[model samples]
Target: MITGDALLLRPWREADAAELVRVQRGDAALRRWTGAAVDDEAAALAWIAGQARGWETGDRLGFAVVAADARNCAAEEGELLGHIALKDVLSGDGRAEVGYWTAARARGRGVAPRALTALTGWAFGRGLTRLELLHEMDNTASCRVALKSGYERAGVLPAAPPEFPLDGCLHACRPGA
Candidate 1:
Protein backbone atom coordinates (compact mmCIF):
# COMPACT_ATOMS: atom_id res chain seq x y z
CA MET A 1 0.00 0.00 0.00
CA ILE A 2 2.96 2.28 0.56
CA THR A 3 6.30 2.65 -1.16
CA GLY A 4 9.31 4.64 -0.06
CA ASP A 5 12.79 5.04 -1.43
CA ALA A 6 14.07 2.12 0.66
CA LEU A 7 11.09 -0.22 0.97
CA LEU A 8 7.54 -1.00 -0.08
CA LEU A 9 4.71 -3.01 1.36
CA ARG A 10 2.71 -5.30 -0.92
CA PRO A 11 0.66 -8.46 -0.86
CA TRP A 12 2.08 -11.94 -0.75
CA ARG A 13 2.31 -14.10 -3.85
CA GLU A 14 2.57 -17.85 -4.39
CA ALA A 15 5.95 -17.48 -6.07
CA ASP A 16 7.30 -15.83 -2.89
CA ALA A 17 7.31 -19.16 -1.09
CA ALA A 18 10.84 -19.98 -2.16
CA GLU A 19 12.19 -16.63 -1.05
CA LEU A 20 10.35 -17.01 2.22
CA VAL A 21 12.03 -20.33 2.81
CA ARG A 22 15.42 -18.98 1.92
CA VAL A 23 15.14 -15.96 4.18
CA GLN A 24 13.74 -17.92 7.10
CA ARG A 25 16.54 -20.44 6.81
CA GLY A 26 19.22 -17.79 6.78
CA ASP A 27 17.98 -15.47 9.53
CA ALA A 28 17.66 -16.84 13.02
CA ALA A 29 16.35 -13.55 14.38
CA LEU A 30 13.61 -13.49 11.79
CA ARG A 31 12.68 -17.08 12.61
CA ARG A 32 12.69 -16.32 16.33
CA TRP A 33 10.59 -13.18 16.07
CA THR A 34 8.14 -14.44 13.44
CA GLY A 35 7.86 -18.04 14.64
CA ALA A 36 7.58 -19.11 11.00
CA ALA A 37 8.69 -22.59 10.05
CA VAL A 38 9.86 -21.96 6.53
CA ASP A 39 13.05 -23.97 6.80
CA ASP A 40 11.57 -26.29 4.17
CA GLU A 41 9.74 -25.64 0.91
CA ALA A 42 6.56 -27.31 2.11
CA ALA A 43 6.46 -25.21 5.24
CA ALA A 44 7.01 -21.98 3.33
CA LEU A 45 4.20 -22.80 0.88
CA ALA A 46 1.89 -23.64 3.73
CA TRP A 47 2.76 -20.40 5.45
CA ILE A 48 1.93 -18.39 2.35
CA ALA A 49 -1.24 -20.40 1.83
CA GLY A 50 -2.36 -19.72 5.37
CA GLN A 51 -1.80 -15.99 4.92
CA ALA A 52 -3.93 -16.15 1.77
CA ARG A 53 -6.63 -17.84 3.79
CA GLY A 54 -6.38 -15.12 6.38
CA TRP A 55 -6.79 -12.54 3.67
CA GLU A 56 -9.86 -14.28 2.25
CA THR A 57 -11.38 -14.60 5.70
CA GLY A 58 -10.70 -10.96 6.54
CA ASP A 59 -8.71 -11.99 9.57
CA ARG A 60 -5.54 -10.28 8.33
CA LEU A 61 -3.62 -8.88 5.40
CA GLY A 62 0.03 -9.86 4.95
CA PHE A 63 2.49 -7.74 3.02
CA ALA A 64 5.98 -8.33 1.80
CA VAL A 65 8.46 -5.54 2.55
CA VAL A 66 10.64 -5.23 -0.49
CA ALA A 67 13.04 -2.68 -1.84
CA ALA A 68 11.14 0.26 -3.29
CA ASP A 69 12.85 -0.26 -6.63
CA ALA A 70 10.76 -3.41 -7.03
CA ARG A 71 7.53 -1.44 -6.94
CA ASN A 72 6.26 -1.94 -10.49
CA CYS A 73 6.56 -5.73 -10.34
CA ALA A 74 3.92 -8.06 -8.98
CA ALA A 75 3.67 -8.06 -5.19
CA GLU A 76 6.34 -10.16 -3.54
CA GLU A 77 8.32 -10.27 -6.76
CA GLY A 78 11.36 -8.41 -5.39
CA GLU A 79 14.13 -9.04 -2.96
CA LEU A 80 12.51 -10.46 0.17
CA LEU A 81 13.33 -7.71 2.64
CA GLY A 82 10.79 -8.61 5.30
CA HIS A 83 7.10 -8.97 6.18
CA ILE A 84 4.45 -6.94 7.93
CA ALA A 85 0.81 -7.57 8.66
CA LEU A 86 -2.34 -6.15 10.12
CA LYS A 87 -3.64 -8.95 12.28
CA ASP A 88 -6.79 -9.48 14.33
CA VAL A 89 -8.60 -7.21 11.93
CA LEU A 90 -12.21 -6.28 12.66
CA SER A 91 -13.80 -4.01 10.15
CA GLY A 92 -16.64 -3.11 12.44
CA ASP A 93 -14.25 -2.31 15.27
CA GLY A 94 -11.97 -0.19 13.13
CA ARG A 95 -8.85 -1.64 14.65
CA ALA A 96 -6.12 -4.24 14.13
CA GLU A 97 -2.76 -5.35 15.49
CA VAL A 98 0.47 -4.57 13.67
CA GLY A 99 3.25 -7.10 13.51
CA TYR A 100 6.45 -7.40 11.49
CA TRP A 101 9.80 -9.08 10.86
CA THR A 102 12.81 -7.57 9.15
CA ALA A 103 15.34 -9.67 7.30
CA ALA A 104 18.91 -9.66 8.60
CA ARG A 105 20.15 -7.61 5.69
CA ALA A 106 17.29 -5.16 6.09
CA ARG A 107 17.72 -4.57 9.81
CA GLY A 108 19.03 -1.18 10.98
CA ARG A 109 17.94 0.29 7.65
CA GLY A 110 14.67 1.66 9.08
CA VAL A 111 12.64 -0.97 7.26
CA ALA A 112 10.39 -2.05 10.11
CA PRO A 113 9.43 1.40 11.31
CA ARG A 114 8.89 2.72 7.79
CA ALA A 115 6.81 -0.31 6.90
CA LEU A 116 4.82 0.13 10.09
CA THR A 117 4.10 3.73 9.28
CA ALA A 118 2.90 2.86 5.80
CA LEU A 119 0.84 -0.07 7.02
CA THR A 120 -0.78 2.08 9.68
CA GLY A 121 -1.66 4.74 7.15
CA TRP A 122 -2.99 2.14 4.73
CA ALA A 123 -5.13 0.45 7.36
CA PHE A 124 -6.54 3.78 8.44
CA GLY A 125 -7.35 4.69 4.86
CA ARG A 126 -9.15 1.36 4.51
CA GLY A 127 -11.48 2.34 7.41
CA LEU A 128 -9.53 1.20 10.44
CA THR A 129 -9.33 3.92 13.08
CA ARG A 130 -6.94 2.27 15.49
CA LEU A 131 -3.80 0.18 15.21
CA GLU A 132 -1.89 -1.62 17.94
CA LEU A 133 1.65 -2.90 18.11
CA LEU A 134 2.93 -5.22 20.84
CA HIS A 135 6.43 -6.48 21.37
CA GLU A 136 8.38 -8.27 24.05
CA MET A 137 9.63 -5.94 26.72
CA ASP A 138 13.16 -6.78 25.78
CA ASN A 139 12.56 -6.14 22.12
CA THR A 140 13.85 -2.60 22.08
CA ALA A 141 14.00 -2.53 18.32
CA SER A 142 10.34 -3.41 17.91
CA CYS A 143 9.43 -0.86 20.50
CA ARG A 144 11.38 1.73 18.58
CA VAL A 145 9.42 0.91 15.46
CA ALA A 146 6.14 1.34 17.31
CA LEU A 147 7.14 4.69 18.68
CA LYS A 148 8.62 5.91 15.40
CA SER A 149 5.46 4.78 13.63
CA GLY A 150 3.47 7.04 15.98
CA TYR A 151 2.08 4.48 18.35
CA GLU A 152 1.78 5.45 22.00
CA ARG A 153 2.42 3.18 24.89
CA ALA A 154 -0.94 1.75 25.89
CA GLY A 155 -0.22 -0.87 28.53
CA VAL A 156 1.92 -3.82 29.47
CA LEU A 157 1.09 -7.51 29.55
CA PRO A 158 2.60 -9.75 32.16
CA ALA A 159 3.35 -12.42 29.62
CA ALA A 160 3.87 -12.54 25.91
CA PRO A 161 2.94 -15.26 23.43
CA PRO A 162 4.66 -18.63 23.42
CA GLU A 163 7.04 -17.56 20.71
CA PHE A 164 8.28 -14.77 22.94
CA PRO A 165 8.14 -15.93 26.51
CA LEU A 166 8.55 -12.57 28.17
CA ASP A 167 6.60 -9.59 29.27
CA GLY A 168 5.43 -7.18 26.59
CA CYS A 169 4.25 -3.65 26.09
CA LEU A 170 1.20 -2.72 24.08
CA HIS A 171 1.27 0.39 21.92
CA ALA A 172 -1.57 1.97 20.04
CA CYS A 173 -2.24 4.68 17.46
CA ARG A 174 -5.41 6.21 16.17
CA PRO A 175 -6.30 8.24 13.15
CA GLY A 176 -6.05 12.00 13.67
CA ALA A 177 -4.89 11.47 17.19
Candidate 2:
Protein backbone atom coordinates (compact mmCIF):
# COMPACT_ATOMS: atom_id res chain seq x y z
CA MET A 1 0.00 0.00 0.00
CA ILE A 2 1.17 3.55 -0.74
CA THR A 3 0.51 5.80 2.22
CA GLY A 4 -0.10 9.49 1.80
CA ASP A 5 -0.65 12.08 4.50
CA ALA A 6 -4.41 11.85 4.28
CA LEU A 7 -5.01 8.82 2.08
CA LEU A 8 -3.81 5.27 1.43
CA LEU A 9 -3.80 3.44 -1.88
CA ARG A 10 -4.12 -0.32 -1.67
CA PRO A 11 -5.49 -3.31 -3.51
CA TRP A 12 -9.26 -3.78 -3.51
CA ARG A 13 -10.89 -6.33 -1.25
CA GLU A 14 -14.14 -8.26 -1.53
CA ALA A 15 -15.49 -6.49 1.54
CA ASP A 16 -15.30 -3.23 -0.32
CA ALA A 17 -17.52 -4.31 -3.19
CA ALA A 18 -20.69 -2.81 -1.74
CA GLU A 19 -19.09 0.54 -1.01
CA LEU A 20 -17.49 0.50 -4.44
CA VAL A 21 -20.82 -0.10 -6.03
CA ARG A 22 -22.41 2.66 -4.01
CA VAL A 23 -19.83 5.10 -5.23
CA GLN A 24 -20.12 4.09 -8.85
CA ARG A 25 -23.88 3.82 -9.06
CA GLY A 26 -25.90 7.03 -9.39
CA ASP A 27 -22.70 9.06 -9.62
CA ALA A 28 -22.84 11.51 -12.47
CA ALA A 29 -19.12 12.18 -12.51
CA LEU A 30 -18.28 8.50 -12.91
CA ARG A 31 -20.82 8.09 -15.65
CA ARG A 32 -19.48 11.13 -17.44
CA TRP A 33 -15.93 9.88 -17.51
CA THR A 34 -16.26 6.11 -17.47
CA GLY A 35 -19.81 5.23 -18.54
CA ALA A 36 -19.62 3.13 -15.39
CA ALA A 37 -21.46 -0.17 -15.85
CA VAL A 38 -21.31 -1.20 -12.25
CA ASP A 39 -24.84 0.07 -11.75
CA ASP A 40 -26.24 -3.08 -10.11
CA GLU A 41 -25.07 -5.52 -7.48
CA ALA A 42 -24.22 -8.18 -10.04
CA ALA A 43 -22.35 -5.78 -12.25
CA ALA A 44 -20.46 -4.56 -9.22
CA LEU A 45 -19.44 -8.10 -8.42
CA ALA A 46 -18.28 -8.62 -11.95
CA TRP A 47 -16.29 -5.42 -11.88
CA ILE A 48 -14.48 -6.53 -8.76
CA ALA A 49 -13.77 -9.89 -10.33
CA GLY A 50 -12.49 -8.22 -13.45
CA GLN A 51 -10.05 -6.18 -11.41
CA ALA A 52 -8.77 -9.34 -9.81
CA ARG A 53 -8.33 -10.92 -13.22
CA GLY A 54 -6.53 -7.81 -14.45
CA TRP A 55 -4.13 -8.11 -11.58
CA GLU A 56 -3.44 -11.75 -12.41
CA THR A 57 -2.93 -10.96 -16.10
CA GLY A 58 -0.47 -8.15 -15.29
CA ASP A 59 -2.12 -5.78 -17.73
CA ARG A 60 -3.99 -3.60 -15.24
CA LEU A 61 -4.17 -2.87 -11.54
CA GLY A 62 -6.79 -1.08 -9.47
CA PHE A 63 -6.29 0.47 -6.09
CA ALA A 64 -8.82 1.60 -3.54
CA VAL A 65 -8.15 4.92 -1.82
CA VAL A 66 -8.78 5.11 1.88
CA ALA A 67 -8.24 7.56 4.69
CA ALA A 68 -4.75 7.15 6.06
CA ASP A 69 -3.39 7.28 9.63
CA ALA A 70 -6.82 6.16 10.77
CA ARG A 71 -8.11 9.66 10.35
CA ASN A 72 -11.73 8.62 10.80
CA CYS A 73 -12.86 11.02 8.14
CA ALA A 74 -16.01 9.08 7.54
CA ALA A 75 -16.86 7.21 10.76
CA GLU A 76 -13.80 4.94 10.88
CA GLU A 77 -10.27 4.31 9.84
CA GLY A 78 -9.53 3.14 6.31
CA GLU A 79 -12.63 4.84 5.07
CA LEU A 80 -13.01 4.64 1.32
CA LEU A 81 -11.98 7.86 -0.41
CA GLY A 82 -11.99 6.79 -4.05
CA HIS A 83 -10.16 4.62 -6.60
CA ILE A 84 -7.30 4.76 -9.07
CA ALA A 85 -6.14 2.51 -11.89
CA LEU A 86 -3.16 1.89 -14.12
CA LYS A 87 -4.36 0.24 -17.33
CA ASP A 88 -3.79 -0.06 -21.05
CA VAL A 89 -0.35 -1.16 -19.94
CA LEU A 90 2.36 -1.53 -22.56
CA SER A 91 4.58 -3.88 -20.65
CA GLY A 92 6.97 -4.33 -23.55
CA ASP A 93 7.56 -0.60 -23.91
CA GLY A 94 7.02 0.19 -20.22
CA ARG A 95 4.12 2.62 -20.55
CA ALA A 96 0.60 2.89 -19.18
CA GLU A 97 -2.44 5.11 -18.78
CA VAL A 98 -3.95 6.21 -15.46
CA GLY A 99 -7.52 6.95 -14.43
CA TYR A 100 -9.09 7.93 -11.12
CA TRP A 101 -12.13 9.30 -9.29
CA THR A 102 -12.48 10.95 -5.90
CA ALA A 103 -15.52 10.01 -3.87
CA ALA A 104 -18.17 12.67 -3.42
CA ARG A 105 -17.25 13.35 0.17
CA ALA A 106 -13.57 13.29 -0.71
CA ARG A 107 -13.68 15.66 -3.62
CA GLY A 108 -11.57 18.85 -3.35
CA ARG A 109 -9.47 17.20 -0.69
CA GLY A 110 -6.48 16.31 -2.91
CA VAL A 111 -7.16 12.57 -2.70
CA ALA A 112 -7.02 11.87 -6.40
CA PRO A 113 -3.85 13.80 -7.09
CA ARG A 114 -1.98 12.30 -4.19
CA ALA A 115 -3.07 8.79 -5.10
CA LEU A 116 -2.09 9.45 -8.70
CA THR A 117 1.33 10.82 -7.80
CA ALA A 118 2.09 7.83 -5.63
CA LEU A 119 0.93 5.39 -8.31
CA THR A 120 2.97 7.19 -10.96
CA GLY A 121 6.12 6.87 -8.89
CA TRP A 122 5.40 3.23 -8.13
CA ALA A 123 4.84 2.34 -11.78
CA PHE A 124 7.90 4.26 -12.94
CA GLY A 125 10.05 2.58 -10.29
CA ARG A 126 8.92 -0.74 -11.71
CA GLY A 127 10.43 0.28 -15.09
CA LEU A 128 7.62 2.21 -16.70
CA THR A 129 8.90 4.83 -19.15
CA ARG A 130 5.78 7.00 -19.17
CA LEU A 131 2.37 7.39 -17.58
CA GLU A 132 -0.56 9.02 -19.29
CA LEU A 133 -3.78 10.69 -18.02
CA LEU A 134 -6.67 11.48 -20.28
CA HIS A 135 -9.98 13.20 -19.53
CA GLU A 136 -12.83 15.10 -21.07
CA MET A 137 -11.91 18.68 -21.91
CA ASP A 138 -14.58 20.09 -19.61
CA ASN A 139 -13.28 18.32 -16.57
CA THR A 140 -11.10 21.13 -15.35
CA ALA A 141 -10.76 19.57 -11.93
CA SER A 142 -9.30 16.42 -13.43
CA CYS A 143 -7.00 18.52 -15.56
CA ARG A 144 -5.71 20.12 -12.40
CA VAL A 145 -5.15 16.74 -10.83
CA ALA A 146 -3.15 15.52 -13.83
CA LEU A 147 -1.00 18.63 -13.88
CA LYS A 148 -0.39 18.57 -10.14
CA SER A 149 0.59 14.93 -10.45
CA GLY A 150 3.38 16.08 -12.82
CA TYR A 151 1.90 15.38 -16.26
CA GLU A 152 2.23 17.80 -19.13
CA ARG A 153 -0.53 18.23 -21.64
CA ALA A 154 0.24 16.35 -24.85
CA GLY A 155 -2.74 17.33 -27.02
CA VAL A 156 -6.44 16.91 -27.56
CA LEU A 157 -7.83 13.75 -29.14
CA PRO A 158 -10.66 14.60 -31.48
CA ALA A 159 -11.82 11.02 -31.53
CA ALA A 160 -12.09 10.68 -27.77
CA PRO A 161 -14.99 13.08 -27.31
CA PRO A 162 -17.33 11.23 -29.65
CA GLU A 163 -17.25 8.05 -27.63
CA PHE A 164 -17.57 9.83 -24.28
CA PRO A 165 -18.81 13.24 -25.31
CA LEU A 166 -16.71 16.49 -25.26
CA ASP A 167 -13.16 16.79 -26.60
CA GLY A 168 -10.38 14.97 -24.81
CA CYS A 169 -7.07 16.10 -23.41
CA LEU A 170 -4.02 13.86 -23.05
CA HIS A 171 -1.28 14.45 -20.53
CA ALA A 172 1.91 12.49 -19.93
CA CYS A 173 4.98 12.35 -17.70
CA ARG A 174 8.27 10.54 -18.02
CA PRO A 175 9.92 8.56 -15.23
CA GLY A 176 12.11 11.43 -14.05
CA ALA A 177 10.22 14.32 -15.53
Candidate 3:
Protein backbone atom coordinates (compact mmCIF):
# COMPACT_ATOMS: atom_id res chain seq x y z
CA MET A 1 0.00 0.00 0.00
CA ILE A 2 1.08 3.58 -0.69
CA THR A 3 0.16 6.38 1.66
CA GLY A 4 -0.02 10.05 0.92
CA ASP A 5 -0.85 12.94 3.19
CA ALA A 6 -4.57 12.43 2.81
CA LEU A 7 -4.92 9.32 0.69
CA LEU A 8 -4.09 5.65 0.72
CA LEU A 9 -3.46 3.69 -2.49
CA ARG A 10 -4.11 -0.03 -2.14
CA PRO A 11 -5.27 -3.02 -4.12
CA TRP A 12 -8.85 -3.21 -5.35
CA ARG A 13 -11.17 -5.55 -3.50
CA GLU A 14 -14.38 -7.48 -4.18
CA ALA A 15 -16.19 -5.30 -1.67
CA ASP A 16 -15.36 -2.25 -3.79
CA ALA A 17 -17.59 -3.44 -6.62
CA ALA A 18 -20.77 -1.74 -5.41
CA GLU A 19 -19.00 1.54 -4.75
CA LEU A 20 -17.31 1.37 -8.12
CA VAL A 21 -20.66 0.94 -9.84
CA ARG A 22 -22.15 3.82 -7.89
CA VAL A 23 -19.26 6.16 -8.66
CA GLN A 24 -19.22 5.34 -12.34
CA ARG A 25 -22.97 5.76 -12.60
CA GLY A 26 -23.02 9.12 -10.83
CA ASP A 27 -19.85 10.71 -12.21
CA ALA A 28 -20.40 12.04 -15.71
CA ALA A 29 -16.80 13.16 -16.14
CA LEU A 30 -15.59 9.65 -15.29
CA ARG A 31 -17.90 8.05 -17.82
CA ARG A 32 -16.97 10.61 -20.46
CA TRP A 33 -13.26 10.19 -19.94
CA THR A 34 -12.98 6.45 -19.35
CA GLY A 35 -15.96 5.17 -21.38
CA ALA A 36 -16.29 2.53 -18.72
CA ALA A 37 -19.55 0.65 -18.39
CA VAL A 38 -19.30 -0.63 -14.85
CA ASP A 39 -23.01 -0.10 -14.30
CA ASP A 40 -23.69 -3.09 -12.07
CA GLU A 41 -22.12 -4.99 -9.22
CA ALA A 42 -21.29 -7.92 -11.45
CA ALA A 43 -19.46 -5.75 -13.96
CA ALA A 44 -17.65 -3.96 -11.19
CA LEU A 45 -16.60 -7.25 -9.64
CA ALA A 46 -15.31 -8.44 -12.98
CA TRP A 47 -13.30 -5.29 -13.39
CA ILE A 48 -11.85 -5.67 -9.92
CA ALA A 49 -11.03 -9.27 -10.62
CA GLY A 50 -9.26 -8.28 -13.78
CA GLN A 51 -7.14 -5.90 -11.76
CA ALA A 52 -6.17 -8.76 -9.48
CA ARG A 53 -5.26 -10.93 -12.43
CA GLY A 54 -3.17 -8.11 -13.79
CA TRP A 55 -1.23 -8.11 -10.54
CA GLU A 56 -0.68 -11.84 -10.79
CA THR A 57 0.58 -11.43 -14.34
CA GLY A 58 2.54 -8.21 -13.67
CA ASP A 59 1.06 -6.67 -16.79
CA ARG A 60 -0.97 -4.05 -14.93
CA LEU A 61 -0.96 -2.73 -11.39
CA GLY A 62 -4.20 -1.12 -10.19
CA PHE A 63 -4.95 0.57 -6.91
CA ALA A 64 -8.02 1.73 -5.13
CA VAL A 65 -7.42 5.27 -3.89
CA VAL A 66 -9.14 5.82 -0.59
CA ALA A 67 -9.19 8.34 2.23
CA ALA A 68 -6.26 8.08 4.64
CA ASP A 69 -8.54 8.32 7.64
CA ALA A 70 -9.55 4.74 6.98
CA ARG A 71 -5.97 3.50 7.02
CA ASN A 72 -6.53 1.38 10.11
CA CYS A 73 -9.45 -0.43 8.56
CA ALA A 74 -9.44 -3.27 6.09
CA ALA A 75 -8.66 -2.32 2.49
CA GLU A 76 -12.32 -2.66 1.50
CA GLU A 77 -13.61 -0.66 4.42
CA GLY A 78 -12.12 2.61 3.27
CA GLU A 79 -14.21 5.28 1.60
CA LEU A 80 -13.58 4.99 -2.11
CA LEU A 81 -11.93 8.17 -3.34
CA GLY A 82 -10.70 7.27 -6.80
CA HIS A 83 -8.84 4.72 -8.94
CA ILE A 84 -5.33 4.66 -10.40
CA ALA A 85 -3.25 2.19 -12.34
CA LEU A 86 -0.05 1.59 -14.19
CA LYS A 87 -0.99 -0.28 -17.35
CA ASP A 88 0.70 -1.88 -20.33
CA VAL A 89 3.69 -3.00 -18.28
CA LEU A 90 6.03 -5.60 -19.70
CA SER A 91 8.65 -7.51 -17.81
CA GLY A 92 12.18 -6.06 -18.19
CA ASP A 93 10.69 -2.85 -19.61
CA GLY A 94 11.36 0.31 -17.66
CA ARG A 95 8.33 2.13 -19.06
CA ALA A 96 4.63 2.07 -18.22
CA GLU A 97 1.54 4.21 -18.67
CA VAL A 98 -0.34 5.69 -15.76
CA GLY A 99 -4.04 6.51 -15.63
CA TYR A 100 -6.42 7.66 -12.96
CA TRP A 101 -9.81 9.20 -12.12
CA THR A 102 -11.00 10.94 -8.99
CA ALA A 103 -14.36 10.43 -7.36
CA ALA A 104 -16.63 13.42 -7.82
CA ARG A 105 -16.77 14.23 -4.14
CA ALA A 106 -12.99 13.98 -3.89
CA ARG A 107 -12.24 16.61 -6.50
CA GLY A 108 -10.42 19.84 -5.50
CA ARG A 109 -8.79 18.00 -2.60
CA GLY A 110 -5.53 17.19 -4.42
CA VAL A 111 -6.40 13.52 -4.29
CA ALA A 112 -5.37 12.62 -7.84
CA PRO A 113 -1.99 14.28 -7.81
CA ARG A 114 -1.14 13.05 -4.33
CA ALA A 115 -2.03 9.51 -5.17
CA LEU A 116 -0.25 9.81 -8.51
CA THR A 117 2.90 11.16 -6.91
CA ALA A 118 2.94 8.33 -4.42
CA LEU A 119 2.38 5.76 -7.11
CA THR A 120 5.05 7.22 -9.34
CA GLY A 121 7.53 7.13 -6.48
CA TRP A 122 6.67 3.52 -5.77
CA ALA A 123 6.99 2.57 -9.44
CA PHE A 124 10.35 4.24 -9.75
CA GLY A 125 11.51 2.53 -6.59
CA ARG A 126 10.72 -0.76 -8.25
CA GLY A 127 13.09 0.24 -11.13
CA LEU A 128 10.67 1.75 -13.60
CA THR A 129 12.74 4.49 -15.23
CA ARG A 130 9.93 6.25 -17.04
CA LEU A 131 6.18 6.66 -16.81
CA GLU A 132 3.72 8.23 -19.24
CA LEU A 133 0.45 9.95 -18.55
CA LEU A 134 -2.09 10.64 -21.23
CA HIS A 135 -5.41 12.42 -21.19
CA GLU A 136 -7.78 13.92 -23.75
CA MET A 137 -6.56 17.32 -24.84
CA ASP A 138 -9.58 19.01 -23.34
CA ASN A 139 -9.02 17.59 -19.88
CA THR A 140 -7.30 20.55 -18.27
CA ALA A 141 -7.64 19.04 -14.82
CA SER A 142 -5.64 16.00 -15.80
CA CYS A 143 -3.13 18.23 -17.49
CA ARG A 144 -2.68 20.11 -14.27
CA VAL A 145 -2.31 16.89 -12.34
CA ALA A 146 0.36 15.69 -14.73
CA LEU A 147 2.29 18.90 -14.44
CA LYS A 148 1.99 18.91 -10.66
CA SER A 149 3.18 15.36 -10.47
CA GLY A 150 6.38 16.10 -12.43
CA TYR A 151 5.39 14.88 -15.88
CA GLU A 152 6.56 17.01 -18.75
CA ARG A 153 4.36 17.61 -21.77
CA ALA A 154 5.90 15.44 -24.46
CA GLY A 155 3.63 15.86 -27.47
CA VAL A 156 0.16 15.31 -28.83
CA LEU A 157 -1.04 11.83 -29.63
CA PRO A 158 -3.17 11.62 -32.75
CA ALA A 159 -6.67 10.37 -32.27
CA ALA A 160 -7.48 6.71 -32.83
CA PRO A 161 -11.08 6.67 -33.95
CA PRO A 162 -13.99 5.02 -32.14
CA GLU A 163 -12.33 4.70 -28.77
CA PHE A 164 -10.33 7.92 -28.81
CA PRO A 165 -12.11 10.43 -31.01
CA LEU A 166 -10.01 13.37 -29.83
CA ASP A 167 -6.31 14.02 -29.79
CA GLY A 168 -4.61 13.59 -26.45
CA CYS A 169 -1.81 15.31 -24.58
CA LEU A 170 1.13 13.03 -23.87
CA HIS A 171 3.17 13.62 -20.74
CA ALA A 172 6.27 11.78 -19.63
CA CYS A 173 8.25 11.56 -16.40
CA ARG A 174 11.42 9.86 -15.31
CA PRO A 175 12.90 8.89 -11.99
CA GLY A 176 14.20 11.78 -9.82
CA ALA A 177 12.71 14.30 -12.22
CA lDDT, every model vs. true structure: 0.82, 0.83, 0.90
Measured against the true structure, the TM-scores of the candidates, in listed sequence, are 0.90, 0.89, 0.94
Model 3 misplaced stretches (Cα beyond 4 Å): 70-76
lDDT of candidate 3 over 1-22, digit per residue (tens): 8886777889998988988988
How would you encode candidate 1's per-residue C-alpha lDDT over 15-88 as one tens digit per residue? 88888887888676776666666888788788888889888998889988888664554443567789999999
lDDT of 2: 0.83
RMSD of 2: 2.8
lDDT over C-alpha atoms for residue 134 of model 2: 90
Model 3 global lDDT (CA atoms, 0 to 1): 0.90
| Clash pairs (backbone) in predicted model 3 | none
Ranking by lDDT: 3, 2, 1
lDDT of 1: 0.82
The regions of model 1 sitting more than 4 angstroms off are 70-76, 160-164
